[model samples]
Each structure stands twice: as C-alpha cells, then as structure tokens.
Target: MKRLTSILLSLLIVGSSVLGGCKNKNTSEGKTPESSAATSSVAAPTDKEADIVVIGGGGAGMTAALQASQNGAKNVVIVEKMPQTGGNTVYATGGLNASETSVQKKLNVKDSNQSFIDETIAGGKKLNNPELVKTMVEGSAAAVDWINQIGGDLSELGRSGGMSVDRLHRPKGGAAVGPMIVKTLNENIEKENIPVLLNTTAKEIVLNDKNAIAGVKVADASGEYTIKCKAVVLAAGGFGANSDMVVKYAPNLKGFGTTNHKGATGDGIILAEKANAALVDMEKIQTHPTVEPSTSVMYTEGVRGDGGILVNKEGKRFINELETRDVVSAAILEQPEAISFLIFDQAVREKLSAIEKYINLKIIEEAETPEELAKKIGVDPAAFAETMKAYSQAAASGVDKDFGRKEMKSKLDKPKYYAGKCAPAIHHTMGGVKINTVCEVLKADNAAIPGFFAAGEVTGGVHGGNRIGGNAMADIIVFGRIAANSACKYVEANGGYTEPSIVLEEAETPAVPEVKGNFKDGEYTGKGKGNNGDIEVKVTVKDSSIVSIQVTKHSETPGIYENAEKNVINSIIKKQALKVDTVAGATNSSKGIMEAVNNALNQK
Candidate 1:
C-alpha cells in the first residue's frame, strides 16, 4: 500500500510541473494565443514563427512591425523584453520636428526641407551622414501625415532648441508627444492584429548557412526558442541606460544618471556587432541639463522653449536656455555644485501640460513670489528678483539683451512661481550600428547585410555627434517605415515567406511565484521604487482577503502611471493575490505597485 501511494504522489508532482509550464502567456491587450492565426493560417507548432521579427517593441519597433504588415508581410511579431511595449518613448516630452508639413502650412509657419537639412547637419556638427540627413528631412512631411492618418494629433506647432523656425509638432494641448505616439501605435497594432510578445527577449539573430537572415533566437519564461523568419529589423534603442557601455564610450559621463528606459541597454548594437555590422560615432553622447538630480526625471526642453529660466546659486540667469542641449548642459555644469534651478510662472506651466506632471511628482517648488521661491530654493532673493525683472523686460521687448536668446515667448510675470532643482544627466546616445538611407544595416566594408535592417537609435549617422531636440521622433518614424519597406522587398525577392515549424522544449516557468502565507486582516501602507521615484499604496484587507488597494502617493510618469495603477491594482484585488502580471509599456510602475502591495502584506 505504501509503495502504491508513493507512485501516485510522484505522478501528481509530474502533472503539476507540466501544468505550470503550460500557464497562460503574457500578451498585449487584444492579442490572442493562437500562434497559427497570428502568423499564418498554417497549423501551429511548438515554437513560434513569423515572416518578420522586430526585436524591440518601442516606438521604432512597433512602427516597423506595422509598416511591414502593411507592406505585405503575412506574419509579423514584436518581441519586447520589458513588461510593456513603450521603451524610452513613453518618457519623451518633446515634439516631432518636421518641415513642409500641413501643420506648418496651416499655422503660417515658413519652413523648408533645405533649411531643416542645413540645421540638422549643423546641429550634428557636420559629422552626420549627409545622405541620411537629406532622407530624413525629405520624408519629414510624409511622416507627419502618416502619424495623422493613424489618428495621432500633431497639429499644434512649437519650436524646439536649435531650430530656426516653429517646426516642432505635437498634440493640440502642448501635451507630451511621446506617450501619445506610443498609445496611437499600440492601438493600431491591436487593430491590425499584430502579436506582441511581452516579457520576451531576443537572445540572438540566427543567420542561415548562406550568410542570410534565417530566424531569431529568443527567450521567455518558457526558455529559449527560435522564431523562424526571413528578415529581421533591429529597432532596439541605444545604451544610455547602460552605465558600463556609456562609461566605455564616453568616460567623462561617469556617474551621470540616465533619462532612458531600463531596456535601452544597447542590446541591438551588441547583436549587430555579433553580425559583423559596422558602427559609427560611438563616442558621442548627449546630456540634458534639466534632469531632477535625485530622481533623474528630465524636465522637457519645452519648459525653456515656452519661457523658463535657469538660475545659478547666485540667483542670476546663466546661459541662454534656448541654446542646444549640449551647450546648456555645459553651462549648468560650470555652475556651483554643478546644479541649477528651472524657474517658471503659472503662465508657462499653463501653456505646457507636461509641467503638470512635474507638479504632481512634488518635484516643483511653488511660491507666489520670486523672493519666496528664491528663499525656498536656497538662492539669493535680491539677485533672483533682479534677474526676473530683467527677464520680464526682455520678454516684453522681444529682445534678450543679457544672453542674446532669440525666442523669448513670455515674460513669466504671473504669480505662483514654480522652481525645480536640476543638473546634467546622460540623455541620448548618438552612436550605433551604421545603416544606409534605405535602412539596410551595413558591414565594415560599407556593404549591406543581406536581410538585415536597422532603424531608430540602434543605427547611428542620423544625428552625427549630437541629436537636435524633436528630431529623434522624426528619425524613428521615417526610418522605421523605411526599414520595414526594405525588409519586405528583400523577403519578396529572396524566396518569399515560409511557414515556421520548429520543435520547442519545455522549460521552467518564470512567472512570479504564487503569493503564499495568509495575511493578517488590517489596512497597511507600503512603498516601492517606480520609474521616477517611490510609489506608496494603502491596502485594505477584509477576512484575510485584499478588499482594495489605493495609490495614496506616487511620483511615476503621468500617462504611464494611470495605466499601471488601473490594471495592476485591479488585478491584485480581483485575484486576492500578488501574482498579477505587469501592464505592457508600464512595467516599472506596475512592478512598483505590486512591490508596494507585497510589502504591505508581508510587513517588510
């Protein structure tokens, strides 16, 4: 009887293991698990397959996947390593730089492609590949139209630093542009039925024996598997978040905080390097001057573009706030303690919806008068009042006599002044794998790698040594579509699409271990680190079951925090457990909320 019982127990354990491995896959909203339907009408296999595999699910990768599908690729897949699709794009607060667009025409803003080209080349310090610059400028109008066609709003026109005209396009209310773009693209991806594999990482680009693209080796909770494909687009972002990579290339930026998403770790560059792709301008990195020193939150350049001032410890206006980011950051670094304060009035804040986020994060110091603001921020009150008076006069006269700043839009004389402490932090990495105008990844000999393409921050030469504000948006949209079009053409000319059929091996599941231990019945508060800072939550329990979870305080990004809070908190309450999945594109915030709940329950 004992022997028979042991055999039955062993059988039960094996069954449980198999069942655990077969748990539900983490997919984007509106995505289905039917692999056959997602890729093709063919029968499903143990492993995944697609006609085109995009390695990153950021703005660039999402755009490429959608464009490839529209260009006749039957099966398209987006692999994102993070819990969400929006990479660093969710953090962008700038506008899209474009010229000769309908928005520019309607707004009576005069702009030309040549002017844009010249400015871009100059901003890049002439280190940019001329061909790439021309291509981007030429396609700017079309990119703007494409965004509009896909239900994205870019009608509002503004100017960014280093621009000669008011050519930056954004949403109607001067809201942050990046999250809007990502949300629109995600909606379109769902509408087109493009399958996005969340929590999946591409391990390697599997090249066939003929030195052409074959498939991509990826890993998920289920272990390693190869997604069979003919062409791959490396739309993964840059290495701004990778301290080692940043220090390796630009050692002077050591210990600087980053404004990039955690996933911007140069995975695409590493992959391209392994594939023998050439790199360019790897040493050039850009730093933004207005990042919050403690939390690394980057204040939008629009703050200054719309009428904000940088004041040193002595309470004097320093550099021209409208200058290029590099120049402004350098000026800030030259100040005492390498820190400065961004001061603006309620009028400037009203013009920019992005400022509301800064207010919500509790980072912005509020005062009804200049002296009060200066005293609160530890600056000379008399000097600050004098600086404000001088700035208001300059704004009223449309002439910056002090710093020669040209675009003084407002006087900032309104009451309820706001200030935030800021310093220089690493922002964008301007170097990566080299690519041609058609978005084909090139080798060291300047020969195109067959069936390999790259776009966005992964491929350099577009920005040269320094990228202009707002051009990063144009670069991703223009080149992402170009990369997809080229990939589709290459696949059509080279044997067409083939259905994938590969055997996948069962591996241990990495799903958050199911929450264990009974909870004591009571309300508890906990905290966790979010994308920008800490997230605190109040948990209510009833009969040892979570009754509700409320976010009492958080410093997360605006749009992103809402999504994660709604989805993650509700899931935890519904399941009465903390094994809920993080929302796509809002992974950090979701994890932070979950961690807070866990801490609350465990009293850790």
Candidate 2:
C-alpha cells in the first residue's frame, strides 16, 4: 500500500508539473492563471514546528520574524503565499515617515512626534486610534535608526503628502524606497539564516483549549500540515487587491483599479476573524491620485512632492498637487472620464530617480517640447503650453497662484517634457483586525488575545481613515518589531514554547525522474513569462550536455529575480536536467527560467 501511495504521489506531481507548464505558457501570452493552477512544485513538510509563526513574508511579516529571533525566540518561521517575499512593499515608491530621526537631524530638518501624530490624525479624518498612533509616533525615530542599522539606505530626507516637514527618509538618489528596504531586509534575513517557507499559505490559526494561539494550519504544494507554535503574528497585508472585499467595504470603489500587489487579499484578516479578533475601520479605503489606469502602477507621491503637476484633459490645474491622497484622488475622479495627467519637466525627472522606472515601463510619454508632449497624451497643445508657462512663473516666484501649492521646487522650462495618463486607484486600506498599542490583537471588549499579535497593514488604527504617503513604511517597521517583542514576552511568561503534541503521518517521498534527452551542441535563445513580464534566456550546450544558461533579458523585480535566476540556472547546469525544483520564494522566475531553458533545448 505504501508503494502504491508513492507511485500515486509521483503521478500527481507529474500531473501538476504538466498543468503548471500549460499555465506558464498562458501566462507568457499575458493571461493570468486561475488560483487552482498556481500551486508550487515543492513538497510541503509533514511535521513542522516553531516557537513563533509569522503569516506572510512581506515587509511586516519578515520584520516580525527577524525581531522574534532577535528577541530570543529559538524557532521562528515565516510562511508566505506568494512566490516572493516583498508583497505590496515591492510596489511602494514613497519613503519612510518618521519624526526627529537622526536622518532628519543630520539634514537639519526639524520635526516632532506630536506634529507627526497630529498630521496623521488629520489625514485619517480624526478616526485613528489615539493610543496606537501615539505609540507609533513615539517609536518612529528608533525605527528609522533600526532600518539604517540593518544595512538599509535612508540617508536622504524628503517631504510627502500630509507631512509638515522633511521626515520621509529614502535612499540618497531619490530612488523608490520599497525595493531598497525589501532588499535590505532580505539580505539581513539571509545573513541570520532565517527560515521562510515560500508558497505556503496559512489556512487557519489553531488555538489551544485556553483560547491561546497553539499552532497554525498551513497548506503548500504537497498537502496541509500543522506548525505548532506558542505565538503567531498576523502580518499579512490589507484587502486592496481583493476587489470583492474592497467593494464590500466601500461600495463606491467598485471597478476601480488597485495599486496593490495580487497578494494583499486580507488573508490575515480572515485568520484573525476565525480567532475572534476585533475588526475596525473596514470601510476606510483610500485611493491614490496618480496611478496608470491600465497597468495599475502608482506614480509615487514623491513625483508631485518634487514638482510634478496634475492637470485635467483641458490642461488646467484644479487642486494642489501635494494635497493628501484622498483629496487629490477625489479631485482626479471629478475630471473627464475620471482621468488626469501627471505632467513634469526634465528637471523634475532628474531630481527623482524613481521616474526612470516609469520611463522603462513605457508609461511616460516624453517629448522635447510641451506642445509635442501634450499632443502625444491627447491633451490640448496650446492650453498645455500656456499651463506650463504659468507654472514656470509660479516656480520662479516661489508661489502657486491657482492651486495654493506651497512647494514649487523647479521651473518647467527644461526640455524633454513628460506626461502620464493617471487616475485614482484603490491604494491603501485603513481598516483591519484591531490591535492595541503593544501590538497585541484585541477582542471586541479591548482585551488582548493571548499569544496573538498583529502589525503593519494587517492591523487597524495606526491610520484612521487615510494612510499618509510614507507612514506605511514606518508603521510596518515600528509595529512589526513591537509585535515580535510582545510575542516573545508572552512566550516567556507562559514557560516558553513547548513541543507540539500533535503527530502527523508522513507522506512518501517521490522518486526523481531521469533526464529524458540531450540538448543540441549550440547556443539557443528562448522566452518565457516571469512575474513582471517576458523573461528571455540564452542557453549554451556543450558535448550534448547543458553547460551554461544566462538570463539575457527580464523585467522581474530586482532583488527577487536574481535569486531565482542564480538558483535555477545553477541547478539546471548541475543536474543536467530541466526538472529541478523551483526557488521557494521566487517560484515564477524559477519556472520562467526553466521553461526558457527547456524551450532552448527543443529548438531544431
């Protein structure tokens, strides 16, 4: 019977691989696969245990795991459903917001935590939880220092919407802060040898008879399993990407494009609900003012904070570009077809390095003259020219006449003008599972759920109704660390993490398949689909054996693709086969590269 079971499992594996291949082919042609076909090929563990289990491997989850480890938790594990760990943090272009930071002090920019709290409350329309916001603000400076100490670059300070000072810290070149922070966190996690289970979903948060967190029920490629633990941190992000959830909370937001990654589907919220945790502010969804409607790519608020202006189809400025996101988004929605254009000159582009990505994505329309750029974007050329002339005058005079804009940093006289068609898109969800100042998950009566903690976008009350541009980063780092610390304390008070009592039956390991065929003795080029777009590779065969594989072109995320490319290519060359296992967190890139190699070998 055991032998029969092994054979059946092997057949199932082969069947899944075939289905995955078909899915990849469809994905290459720009068709997203249904959820059923997106499972990974890696086998799930039958018996797993941890002292602390963190759901989601995005910014908050990773930070919680790392801090738990640092706080002396012996066994800490992170489970992420996505092929990569960044989550929506990968899409964040703004910087980290913190007041009275060393970065701000070094730059001679004055800011106060009280001021930060006040602005955050005003942005949230006074719906924020005062205690949670106060805790976040008080810890903001240390969070900035912590990120810097963890090898992240945040030396440059800039302003963002709803900020009273230059408290937003990013890289020196004004680059997108999300990728940089993700890269830093990933590098540190690797250095610490932390275990992050990719392609693993937390199906349920198991509790003990005492109503405390006892373990987590998780599912991966092989099967469902239980991870016994003393504590669980819910860092899985918001439901901005889940259209049903979004429309359920805010009915008016239906059919709106979202700037969130596909993984922000409120998994943690569901898990918390099952645990009987309180939910708060579920209807407070905020739409960003400048997202490319077709691609759902957000043009960072830093663009407008630097000098970019938003204009209607008639080429007239309607509102202050640096207004809070909710206000700006509402203004944009009132425009023709609910669309507006983000217009900027070459000088503004030079000051912000994040714009290079927009250029690379082919989303930004550029021309040497304002009239030419306007015509390309389907706007009136004369009106746009006059608008640019007036905006230049405002910049020269250090004043905005029409919109009362406060920060006019540059004149619009530089050549090579640019414009991108943008519209308001669902960006941030301010409501989630409720938590206290210490990051403890709360019951409806305001009592802490024993052994349960939450942080980042998974928790509500940090941002009342609307999230500030850079506050999300600060919220994740500060509260993620706090949640870990609280979980560690709880474990210690409960005599630390005890061994799991539940026993699970182990599944038979499948036998490895033999290499089927030899490759032609030459170089071949082939293409496959990656998480971002097409991935092309050049495969070199020598003596009818795979010798080398190189990724010639790809649009995958920077830090993520490198790991998949290196691991998959090296494994293919070493095994001399294409049936290698995909990288844990980078499944899509791994499969894409493997498919490209397989395509290369099949050439006539």
Candidate 3:
C-alpha cells in the first residue's frame, strides 16, 4: 500500500476525471454577512500535523481511533466540531445489531451471520455492495466483543426491522444505547490520553501535488488550522439536519423534521468529495414510523419489536408492526390523519424498561379498560373492543388473519394499556461518500483514494435503499474497525511526523442546570424527552404546591412506569416541587416526570 511517486502522479492525473461528474454544495447559507466587525476580526489559520486524523467522535470515529491505537498507531487524533464527543451515537436508543454474539449464545437466541447477511441485503433492496454487507455481517460478533472489551455494555437483545431473528443488542439499562457506547468509548479514549480537539470543524481535505491526502484544514475557537496527516477518516455523519440537503437530495422529506442531530449536515460528504470521493444513494433517506408528531423525537422500534401493534383512527390493526421501518412508515402515512397509534400491554411493558420514562411524562396514554382508552384517545370504542378481541385470539393461536403478523410474543391483556400517536420523521440518511469493503473512500469509478477512509452514516452502500433500525449501529462499528485496520497498514507502510505540542485532551462533563424560581399555581403541559420518545405532562398547581398530577396521555411502559408515575406524583405532592429521588428500577421515567413537572412550574 506504499504510495510511490508514480502512483501519486497517476492519481493526480485521474483525480479530476474522477470528480468530474460529482456534485457539491454548502449544506446551508447564512442569510446575511455577520456584522462587518465580526468579519474584519477573523483569525488567521494555524498549522499542525498528525499521523492519522479522525474527523468525528461518534461510534465510528471513536472505534476507529481505539482500533488504530491497538494496531500501534501513534499521534492518532480525533477532531470534532461539536463541543463534546459522541455524535449521533449518543442518541440511538435501539442499540447495536449483531448476530451470534456471546450474549446471544448465552441468551439462546437462534441466529446466524448468513441470516443476518440475507436480511440486510433484502432490507437494503439488493443495492448494497455485497462485499461490504458481508464484511459487516462477518465482523459483527467480533465488533460486539470489541465493545465489551472496552468496558461498553451490549447486554440485551431485541428484534428490529429487517432482522430475521432477535439480534439487536442494547445495554440492559433502559436508557439509550448511545450513552453507554459514548461513555465507554470516551472513558477509554481519555484513559489512553488520545488527543481530541473539541469545537474543531474540518473545512476541507488538502491534497499534495500527487493528489493523495496531504492534510486537512480545520476551524475552531482559536481560528482555523491545518492538520497535516498521512491519512484521514471521515465519520462526521449524514445530512438529515440540513434542510437544503434534505430537499435537494430527498425532496420527499421536504416537510419532515429529522431525527438527526443538528451537526449531521454532511460536512464529511463535502470534505471527502473535494478529495475525489463520490457520493451514493444521496436521496435514500429512511424515515422512522413512530416519531412523536410535533416534537419529532423517535419512539424506539423496540416497542414493536417487543410485540406492540399499530392501529389507525378507527382503532383497528393495519400493517404488521414488525415490518421494516420504511414499510411501516409508508403504511402510517397512508392512514387517515397520516398517523397511527402504538399499543402494548403489561407483558410488553415488562420487557421495555425505557417506556417507563415516556409514561411518567404523560406522552403515553393509559387506561383501565380498552373501551375507556379508546374513548380517551378519540378511537371508536366498539371497534377497539372488537379489534382487541380478535387480536387476543390471534395472539393465542399464532395466526394473524388481518395483517399477517408472524410473531406474537405476548398478548395485550393487562390493564392500563399504553398507546401513543405517532407519525413518521426522517430518521437516517442511507447515503453518503462511497467507500469499499475496507472502507477506503472511492471515486465515481470505484477506485480507492488511498489516504482517505469513511465509516458510519457518513458513508453509503451498506444499507442500500432503506436502512433497518439496528443495522446503523452495526454499520458504524464494523466499518469503523475496518477503516482503522486499513489506516494502520497505510501509516506503517509510509511514515509521518507529528507536532509534540499538539497532543490529546479530554473534556469534562458540565453540571446539570437546576430549575429556578418560586412556583405560581396553574395547570400547564410540559414535554420532556424520554428514553425512546417524548413525554408530555399536565401538572396542576395551587397555593404554590403541586396539588395533583394527571397523566392523560403517554406512550411509555405499563407496569414499570405505572409504579413510577404513582411514586413521582406522590413525591411531588409531598415536596411541593420536582426535587425527589427517582424510583429504583424506573429512574428514567421518574426523571422524565420530575423534568416535566419542573418545566410546568417554569412556565410561571
């Protein structure tokens, strides 16, 4: 893999031809110039150098750096534009997807890597590079081991869309999986003293006269700087946050708010393109079916994966809830009101620990009986009763006459059933800079660009047309490791020097903000983000004390959150404020309740 002078000249000659048909544009435009003084005071660009540079701090970037270090890379640096690390990886609640892991073997879930490969190819509509998909599937179990070795947890397994078996692995904790991965990877990165440049934005990829990666230009608080590196790994994520990119690429999503983090504006796509990397499937954006309509916060597919059902306005089951995200979203959008309800009972609630948080916020609706719940949510009571009866029968017999549902893990018989209104939100961009099996960035003709690589959502061709839920995590972790291993080979073959002064640094976590001000008594609705969805609450106050709390609606777990709801309400009444210990085993729901109450009080 050594870059000889002849190869460099050959690359420089064809680089223009490689980029000729590519498209490029800034993700957004600032409407007007900043005040003239702001422009006049612009700082000069600084300069630095490295052996390897990672351009994001998400799952992919973090894994890339750790693997690179393990592979004996020195002066490996991760430059993140955000103030903190953990890009979209911090927000994913559904967890990683892998087959035949040690946990799965212990849990006795039947799965094979071939089954995983088949499902992935089918889910991606066969447009996936088979080689890339195979690589992901083969490396998945080992990737899980890698995460576990780094002190990260991937304990629980659930089924997500496009998986033929129960294989999505999440932290046993009910909270989002991203936090666990981020926490572990971050601690390891810091423990290893890997230099991380926070608030550093990569502006462009600089190439030497031979057209290989020379370095990268970046901007930060101290102004712009050049990071001369023999190789670059672009893991900066996708463009769901950029309205312009969304419209230009996936125009069908013009009106949908994205579930992507704001920083997911395809900066990596722009930067990689300048180095002759081609983009693919840029229009293939996948929308999640269960996003809370107004807030656009995702309702994790685990609900359905654990046996939740979708019902329309008429209170009847429509599509099989276990279908792929794209299929379910289309079914929902075609429904009356362009919305649907997710219904589950105590059995499902027991399995989904995170639902408790949504329940305490009142975003999930609950009721003592089916009829009562139907009346409360504007669904036809009679129709709902009949639907429940038939559904019960189907669950008992394992024969779904209406929608052809194959799996019926539990029956929805328990009282205080949970339901939430849902609509689709753009969830993932199944497209970005093109890369091959080893994760080397490629040109339009599919030739590797040598010194550049990409992993995660920032690279396309893994999940071809429509991405499945849990596969996103797998894509990043698997390819990220591959990218790192390949980069190590490149770095070892060709040597580079790093500046001693520019070393790794870690950021300290900020303290939580306390709710301020004395209470004014009034009923107000407040929404708070839960483990997997948004929770809204109605808190009533009188005499500067929370007199009562009514959970009129919610989409959280039943039994677990039920206890938390009662416990939190009583605690709020006793304390006359949201300051209270979270109920054990239902901490997320309890926190959501307290935050919602605090938000309600803040309205005063």
Candidates 1 and 2 compared by lDDT, better number: 1
Selected candidate, larger lDDT, 1 vs 3? 1
Best by TM-score: 2
- After superposing candidate 3 on the true structure, give the runs of residues whose Cα lies further than 4 Å from its correct spot: 1-45, 173-175, 496-501, 504-604
Each model's lDDT: 0.80, 0.79, 0.75
How do the residues 170-275 of candidate 1 rate in per-residue lDDT, one tens digit apiece?
A: 8887899998888788767755556666567889988878778888888764456788888899999999999999999999999999998888999989998998
Clashing pairs in 1: 84-584, 84-585, 85-585
Q: Flag regions of model 2 displaced more than 4 Å.
A: 1-46, 497-518, 522-538, 552-555, 559-604
Model 3: residue 7 alpha-carbon error in angstroms: 35
Model 2 TM-score on a 0 to 1 scale: 0.86
Q: After aligning candidate 3 to the native by TM-score, how far in Å is the CA of 215 from where it should be?
A: 0.8
lDDT minimum window of 10 residues, candidate 3: 9-18
Worst 10 residues of 1 by lDDT: 2-11
Report the lDDT tens digits of candidate 2 across residue range 472-579. 999999999999999999989977855423221122232222243376788899988776667899987777777778789987766456657765775577568887
